[model samples]
Target: MAADGLDEIDYGILHLLQQNARSTTPVDMAEQLPVTDTTIRNRIDRLEEEGVIEGYVPIVNYEKAGFPIRLQFSCTAPTKKRHQVAGQALELPHVVKVDEMLSARENVQVLAVAKTTEEVNEITAGLDDLPLTIERESLLREERRRPFGHFGQHVVDD
Candidate 1:
């Protein structure tokens, strides 16, 4: 292990997994690293057990899936109750993601997807019921994500 606790092997596993978890195989990862396939599997198991490797989720294109309306709501909640408010926000039907921020104002960020304006209103109503102040709301145009860079060596495009 390196001084930071995770050595090159661990970081390689994380990088490959993050790149494409569904298509990644232990054998494929082992082929890239110096370890065997069994070692790759064992390392993945240990990472999961240690909570370093959390559950994987698919990135859905809501616009193509018929839920074209994507909304982002910035909200403010009592600092002491921010976590609970975020959890409650997640319970709403259209709400997909809730972020609890560490700040005085706009401490909560909510992302919701809906098929129509009514569903959006329903989400807004549900949030209104909570002890939060809706600061601003905007329609999301597009979003993109990539794996953490420091976790592994950067791969150049061909």
Candidate 2:
């Protein structure tokens, strides 16, 4: 949470934007917030500049958008080979994020942002070929979104 002038009203504005940034005009917000349009605009500007607000993004349902599969895999790789495996994983198709875990004992949970079920299977196959053990796997059949659930927003390039 940002401490700079971030009060309840600021949070409210953020909530509104999360659902849709262009939902309310400054004039519309002024009527409800008891603040001027300039105030709202200036605050938004400051939020963007301070890196509190990132960018507007259209929420797309992964399934509807042809990304019919979501897979989470936990596996283990050597500490020395962590960098090498991580680098290669990033280039694999349908991979979204690979995170290193300190408490994993000897495993890492990777949220593969795959485009399809086939892609997910292929990625898993490739990873399986290595000396890594797959601990857990999950298929994301839906794209979940809250009404206004953005704590922070940044540019998401599709």
lDDT value for model 2? 0.68
Each model's C-alpha lDDT? 0.90, 0.68
Clashing pairs in 2: 96-113
| Reference-based TM-score of each model | 0.95, 0.63
Global CA lDDT of candidate 1, please? 0.90
Cα miss at 150, model 1 (Å)?
Answer: 1.2
In candidate 1, what are the lDDT values of residues 32-150, reduced to their tens digit?
87788899899899889989988998999999999999999999999999999999999999899999999999999999999999999999999999999999999999999998977
TM-score (C-alpha, index-matched) for candidate 2: 0.63
Mark the regions of model 1 whose C-alpha exceeds 4 Å error after superposition. Answer: 154-158
lDDT per residue as tens, model 2, 18-129: 6567677777666656567899899788879978799877765666767666787877777777667766666666767787766534456676666655776798887787
Give me the candidate number with maximum lDDT.
Answer: 1
